[model samples]
Target: MTADTSVRFREFKMPDVGEGLTEAEILSWYVKPGDTVTDGQVVCEVETAKAAVELPIPYDGVVHELRFGEGTTVDVGTSIITIDVAPGSGPAEEPAAAEPPAASVPTPTAPAEEAEEKPKGRQPVLVGYGVAESSTKRRPRKQAAPSPEQSAAAAIQAEMNGHGAAPAAPQDRTRPLAKPPVRKLAKDLGIDLATVTPTGPDGIITREDVHAAAAPAPAPAAEAVPAPAPAPEAALVTAGARETRVPIKGVRKATAAAMVGSAFTAPHVTEFVTVDVTRTMKLVEELKADKDMAGLRVNPLLLIAKALLVAIRRNPEVNAAWDEAAQEIVLKHYVNLGIAAATPRGLIVPNIKDAQDKTLPELASALGDLVATAREGKTTPAAMQGGTVTITNVGVFGVDTGTPILNPGESAILAVGAIKLQPWVHKGKIKPRQVTTLALSFDHRLVDGELGSKVLADIAAVLEQPKRLITWA
Candidate 1:
């Protein structure tokens, strides 16, 4: 074969993947330079706005190089991997040519076709489509040979001698049976997986088992590290002049400016209310089993969302925004409920549009969809706009409550707290009940204390007796 026909260097560029996302953060590199890879082999993992995706290589060849390092943000259409492709030859190279753009390259062979045609048990290259299709034709089943008991005396004697020969030295049976990744996790967590009883199927060690075994033992005060020593004469090179700088970029910069603007310009006032949400917790449990709410994530946030919508109807002032230029309170008839989700990127408050129009089941589904999309980083800019009020679920992070800063153009924000079972007075008898705290922060100029309290109390009352939601509706 001619040189051009024998070998070709195929460049694999990062695709949009989906959701029209322009950029992604490189989470990891599965292959490095000089590593031989096959089509459909996973080359790296990229974190998009919505989810972590494993990017597969599109060609069969040795990985020439990874253009971007882990944690580096790369734009779509950037060349991520180069593969030296050769026909028949195990490894080969070709003379350099002017690089072609990613869009000009033809689609590589599908992973399913390659898998069925390739030899059994061979690891495929990183390039190409993922997930091979199953074969349609089934091979004929094989029959086993007759047992030694059915054979002659000489055959029985031979079998007995084979069994008696050393017995495989009692192979290290104490060591746990785990995959390489699980074993790596155990090592990283300082866990002795062998000693940790396996709960996985077939007595295999799992990631959770490793984590549980590696849990740090609580220590007394005596074992705690002491405070750092005072600075020495040489270390005090510039006393009272020490400073550290951090670049304000991405989420940190955006959050900082928003916090400052909200605090200084919005005239904020925060009020706290503790509520017995036992009924709400019980209702959540019931909804989780409900056929109507199937596949929806039933949680306190859903109830809180419903309560907030109801309270907004009762006290519309809480949802009203301050219009400085117009010198008016922009009262919204419909609620666009904003949910503040803390993602890998930072604090992103994406909202549900016209949330007041949704029923309980519809709201639950919307919340589920919203959360799933947000976590995957697929929440559109339009979904994040026109929010009248917001709810920040600090409870997910185990925080009891915090005074949340208002999203720009919104009037109020609510912080949901962690729910815990605590002893409470029920009809003069002490009973264990699920309780939670709610912190409401509002622009004082638009919302008075009476209005804020009423809004909060209305939400608490619904949570205290979730059945009230039906009656209130």
Candidate 2:
């Protein structure tokens, strides 16, 4: 075979590993050009806003080309890799294959528009045979053959001396081209897409461009501006010997945006309580020995989570959200308890759905699975949605307490602080007891001081007397 033998090239578009996620950063490639790969081999790892996932090749093939490099954020449905399915037996080439382009292929436009017409059965999926009808996928909605008014005018003009009416000009010159995810980000940040300058491959407004637009143009030396998520840092730390600027992306970016929105939009009120949790700590040990709880994760966090659930049952009004659009206070009948976990990437709150329905042992098992999945960087975006309340255990970091910020949309969040043996008044006597601080932050718009205080007090009461879990629950 000739060295220049050509074969069929299959382009693999970036899959939406997380449902509806528009873009992902190409972390690394496992195979280079000409490398042999099996059908199920993982070709690359990409980080979506929710989590990092390994993408596997769907068929046996030889790597042909990589369209994007590491650290580049590519939109879903955009080709990221190409493969040669028939390596040795060269396929017939196009008649004009000998000719080359004058320059690089025109940077592709955002594919989100035409994708709306595609049926779900035909679109590319994570782990299956993708119907490879990609060549005709970019078809635009055909305009009904030119209106009759134009045809009549064309006949009159042809009679006057013109052969036919001049073709109508293309109608899409003014629309700003942006992927769906970028557009969603713009909407969330209250940015006008057309006003933002384009820095993407083909005049497409990217997520970064939208963030920059939010910050606005730079000012003179005397003035500075506070930028939003995924934008450059306002101030740099220059004191260190070696400075490394890591561009914020993925989970960290989403967390920053949520925190900023929650901080500014919600009316926050916090209350703190210090309590003796010695009996609760002792119960943890006892549960560990129970055969029903054997092999499950029995830790301080497990009990804390159960206590918060019990409190929610006692004070149901605290488990609610403020809906700005409908201008209503939405109370949740079920609890999706969010656990704020610190991982290598950043802070992610993956909540347990219908947590109130679980038994103590079941909750412990679920908690173990959630933490393990998070630590492995495998938490799906679905696991992080629809949380009714949250518990942030800052105790693991040895901090006393904090005015914890309420998770966006949720009315309340409980911050569990470090547990220490401190001198306390136990039954009218000073004694060393296992004591801890609990801070509860709530949305004042929905949860008043009385309701927030009741919820926090209930949790503290349950910890003080472990028997309350049976009565209150």
Candidate 3:
């Protein structure tokens, strides 16, 4: 029942951006110490295991401190920024021991064993956060005595100082000034910012400082550390020049894991069909000029999406997920149709919810918006969730067909290959026609070979004879 007399500061702890995600790396900070922040203002951007999210400050205050620099991975419920809320307070006069502002809700009484409460002034969290355990509670640390090596170093330093040798004054170890890119480089290399010797003007930490810290430590006593003998012309090490390494994280990491799980867990059966889409191509041009579809995206993908939707309606079993835990097939009545879009970060399939209910124009609009958002790296986690079926157009890349893997959880994914004018027999005569190959890969556990073949055939039939869409719908 005692009142908190410490400096009033609101500690903005990291939230669970996605279900059960424990940590996120700070991408960039929009606010720094001495900057004023308002309620619901985006203070920083963070990249979680799933997606990049902008965290909004929940209350109005002046930023007292940024607990961790950009690129640091902070755990959920851990304070990342402290903001002073008192009317006259400022970052310039921030208290040495600025505690988090306590909650107005009273601490409930509990048994003696559970009486120890969490540290006061902890940031409020959503219900998804796991209950704090004993290990989560901060404990005081007792300093350990120096070891023999450290004692010897101290003696040597004292002897040198007694002889008028200048002592190295401890450098300021407050927040280090570095760009986010430089900080990320340091983090990736496992270099500690505090240990790095800065050479940049204004004492700011630079990318060179971080990389220099990661360089091999100098050899002690050239005599003791013998250099390796030079390699002969036959034993060269130029393999590194031809190879490149990229850190797999974010979308790439998630996609890799999902694809591996899907490939091994699901019994995949892919069926390929080559179709003449000359009629479908003509329809695409017609729809583009239609007033109803004006300002809406009109493309083969849109009609292909509609065709798939119709096929799903005819064979609802194709739009299902294999629930391994439940030992059942979950047939989704509503389709969240995912379109695989490849971005610089990686490939992501963001779906349009209840796509079956959307008319051609509406579906086109949603697809256009989804693609644009994904290209700009602004797609939300919700947009990528609960996908029932997916379409991947490898055709755009000028590649002929590919046996595309089924997206995780989804029963089927259709890959559209490049459409080219190829000689084909029409009405018993060889003529140049728009031809493309479509490959539909599905999980055999949920979709049988007969069902997968029917779905693939349905899509091809609809594309070959565009009038089937009107008749089928």
Candidate 4:
């Protein structure tokens, strides 16, 4: 019996790990061809626009082949790997030789058992992402026979191009091998997919290939007769090496898009206040030594966060989002407090869910976990969503203050500056006091000047007098 008659192959497509994510770049592969894998085993780590996610194989199998290599950005719903489920029955067939020049057109061939058991709706592949409906509905393209004259011309052209013979005309290819997203991209750029050459695995057109096609062709020189001139040693060494170019993707790319959208969409109104945080600093030290907060990460940021929460509680209207589609102000009853942390990948704000209900000790623990996970690059996409308000501390970098932008869909963001012992007015006299500046940027469309001012004032008051946390709450 042949290998195909005994072996069963299953192809795993790239999943949309994050909500509405169209693509992901494979960061690394844990298993390769011929490696035995179990159900729920993580086979590859991929970096989506939101965060890095590990994809787990849904069933036990021996790896048949990996379609794409590491660092390849594959579209969601495109098959990335093939697995041989019944490898023990017989030798697995090599699929590379059977692949067509246009790889986008996949044949709808599945094991009889799989076809019978296939779900009507989407099938779950990864834990959270279900297989797209279109992934399993591929149909073979119908090839039209070429005329005798066309075949003769192709033969002549192939010979003249140094090839002895050719099977089909270059223009005889069926539909261009591109995923739906790639097709849409080409359509948006006004570039025909037929004019682009595919470099993706199995000769499928990629997003890069489309962009390359869309780029304007350089003008041909009218008269090119001059010979090359010798360059100086310094010029030769430094020519075309002035700048370093880095491809923006993953979390950095997401952050950039979000920031741009938030900046432009939201009507920003920033209010600043320099306050004496002497009591807040003292409270932080006391909390660190307290038995209730033992073994927890307690710092000035914790107290600052607590202070901000108390302020929001006092001015509940400030904790809301403007819904453009509905044309309404959506006031949030519960707070998901976002804390901005700078990581190697980029700046990410992972919020604590229902933060308004967490106790001081619980808040400290949550903050600790959030910071630790972010530093290790283990933060998930879910952790970064649904934030009502955000706080960014530039104090760690010894910066005074900055007007922080609001996180998209959120109403306000607070910026905390460095706390330094400076000369200040205390009890009608100049004295060395711990002071810091706070800047609050809010969506002016919903939060008015009075509402924004009250929120900022309340936070400043809480920091100046540590007892107000208990008093205000």
Candidate 5:
């Protein structure tokens, strides 16, 4: 019998995961050159415009090469990995020809049964099946080869050697060199990479180098160039006009398009209600001093988040999506509470799933982790999906109030204004107390004005008197 043979080389490119994202930064590579990979095997981790995503191999084969190294930013449709599918090998193969059709050749159905009954050499495709259609699941820790510290050390060593490492190489670029994470930190802070002086043992860039870069640069010497003779009045002398052009990339670009789209598409109706949050603020102070809540970042937002969860339980209509295709209003029982954070990469709303089930301390920890991940641009795509409702804290920016647009899909969004001490009439007497405004914006189609107003009032009532949360719960 002849040996079945056919070699196919398949190139795997990064796909636009979602949210109209264009480019992504490679976080780590799972398979190295020359390794055998299976279909649906995670090849690398990437950070898109919204969250971190894992890219899987589409076919099983020997990995020919990785096009981009960790920390390199690659555009969509760019080939990231190559696989060689060698013919007639692995667990799959063809069967031997049988004798004259016996009762329809018994319709030889099962591959395993045929293999056992006949002695035919069969070859299967490298990856048994195609890539999984669902989003890649994240392992608790990535299975990539190099540890973060090792990658950092190697990067430093390469930098010291004078020759720059190939941009696609994944060996740690951080050396007595700067680490990739640190380099990322610098980039997010607008620190110039070249100007950051290394401070490590081998003159490698260190965390300190990045921190130093974030510091304000020393003022340049006030060199007095002999002043050019003053231009004559009305002489059409240009005042040394200069225009600076900043390239739109990363966070800035993503935020701009989302804001414009949400603003126009959603019929936004922002209604504000002032609340006396003195009790909520007092609870924050108590939680801050509690020994059990040691590491948690307890703040007014935690209480507000809890209040929102309770209000949502009473008003499920606010937590829903408008499905235009199905022409139905989809209601959700579980809450994925999105917290709108003003990160260096513009504004991002990464949510906490099943937030209603978490205790106050648990909510505090979740908020802390979400903020840290968003700030580092490491929020994963899953975290950004299935958000039922959103909260934007303009108060953080010291602004009293703002009208926020509803997140795409979700029917409602709540904005918390800055909390300040103000003289207000309390129980018929004017007194100084902690006061803030709560603004609720809802989709006129899914959530009516009455429902939106009720939700906003319920949240305010909880903040106005912290004990209401317990009763509602």
Candidate 6:
């Protein structure tokens, strides 16, 4: 057998792991160059904006090259690896044979543009697939005709303004190159893509470029004009060299954007109640020893979650979402209970599907699996979607309570405070009892103050009595 071999490299581009997610950060690689790999073998794990997922190579081949390193964030449709499917099939003396086929390979843009003409079968999924075809076509924006003299004047003005030559006429330049996610982001930030500088590979505008464009530029210092005074000591934090700046991307970035949108877009009203949860705490201990829930997670949170579900059952309207676009209140017949969990990546709310129907032990098991998966960064993007309502247990951190923010698209969120033994008047006697504060934050657009108060009261009532779960539910 000859030691010399010819290489046939097949490039595998990054796929859209989630709906409209433009990019993913390569967390780790499982296969290296020269390693033998079979079809459906996982080659790497990448973290998208939603969740971390393992990507499998769809074809059998030897790993040829890794285009990007670990921790590198790659735009969707960009090639991240190449595999030599026909490794050692040709002799070294026939190296010229490989060159012709390599040269014949079409550019990524051509295949994407012509994909609709191709007879579509079962397209390869995950990592190995190219970009998915858009179902609808967009007509290019009409550009006004410009005279040669006007164009010359514009170019001269652009150069005088230190912007270099004016940008090519709209008809002369191809549409700004950006992926769907980047385009969506630019839209959300109210930025015109043409005005933003492209810093990505091959003149593609990236999320960072959009964000940079969205940020307010510093005012040019002038000797004739006095600078505005700095605001206060609190605002001076940005002036220090000790500050650490973290680039927001992935899950953290998504969370931050979602929270900001939720805060400003939704009218939030929070109702708080301090109640004696002595009975609830006792029930939690009893459930921990129960044979049915022997191995299941039985904590104050489990009971708190059950209580919130009961409250939603009594006030079913509070489980609804406000549809701003449709101008209607969407009443959910089923409840997907989101539990706010702080993970190393960021805060994630992975909900239990159809949680209102689950038994106590079943709900406990579901909660246990959800938490375990989130902590391990294995929660799927689907797991975090379609939540009707949410519960945030700040109590676990020994905090009193918090005005929890409603998760985007959800109507309400319940925040549980620390359970502590405190002196309280019970049966007209001052004695120590387990007490906790519960704060319910809801969107006032759908849930009014009266409805919000009723829900909060019902939750407190459940914890106080600990028997209402059966009666109310």
Order of quality (lDDT): 4, 6, 2, 3, 5, 1
Candidate 5 structure quality by residue, lDDT tens digits, 1-473: 43232335565777998756778877655554445677778777686767666677879766544555555577777666656565334422222121121231122111221113221232121212222222111112225698989888877887788756533433322112344466556644545555677767545567778787667653221111111243244422222335323446555676677778777877778899999998899999998999999999889999999999989998887888888789888989889999988765567788999998899889999999998888766677778888889999999989999888888878889999999999998889999999999999998888888999999999999999889888988
TM-score of each predicted structure versus truth: 0.54, 0.67, 0.71, 0.71, 0.64, 0.68
Q: How accurate is candidate 2 locally (lDDT)?
A: 0.74
All models, RMSD in angstroms: 16.3, 15.8, 11.6, 13.2, 16.7, 15.2
TM-score of predicted model 6?
0.68
lDDT of 1 at 259: 81
Model 4, stretches more than 4 Å misplaced? 3-7, 95-240
Task: State which candidate has the highest TM-score.
Answer: 3
Q: State the displacement of the C-alpha of residue 201, model 1, in Å, after optimal TM-score superposition.
A: 24
Whichever of 5 and 6 has more TM-score, that candidate is 6
Compose the digit string of candidate 1's lDDT tens values, residues 264-326. Answer: 999889999989998888889999999998888788899999998888888877888888999
TM-score pick, better of 1 and 6:
6
Residues forming the 10-long window of minimal summed lDDT in candidate 6: 218-227
Tens-place lDDT per residue, model 3, 1-473, is 32232546667789998777788877767654545567887788787666677789997766655666554567787777776666353223333344532342122111112212223332322112222212222122335988989877887887876843344663443345565556557655656566677787656678888878767652111111011243244423233346435556667788899899889989888899999999999999999999999899899999999999999999998888888888888888999999999976678899999999999889999999999998766787778888999999999999989998989899999999999999999999999999999999998888888998999999999999999988999
In terms of lDDT, the best-performing candidate is 4
Backbone clash tally for model 3? 0
Q: Cα lDDT of model 6 overall? A: 0.75
Model 2, span 419-454: residue lDDT tens:
999999999999999999999999988888999999
In order, candidate lDDTs are: 0.69, 0.74, 0.74, 0.77, 0.69, 0.75
Clashes of 1: 17
Per-residue lDDT tens digits for candidate 6, residues 97-192, read 443224322322211122122223322222333433222222232467889998899889999989888585323222455654565466445466
lDDT of 5 at 183: 53
Model 5 ranges off by over 4 Å? 1-45, 52-77, 81-176, 181-197, 207-241
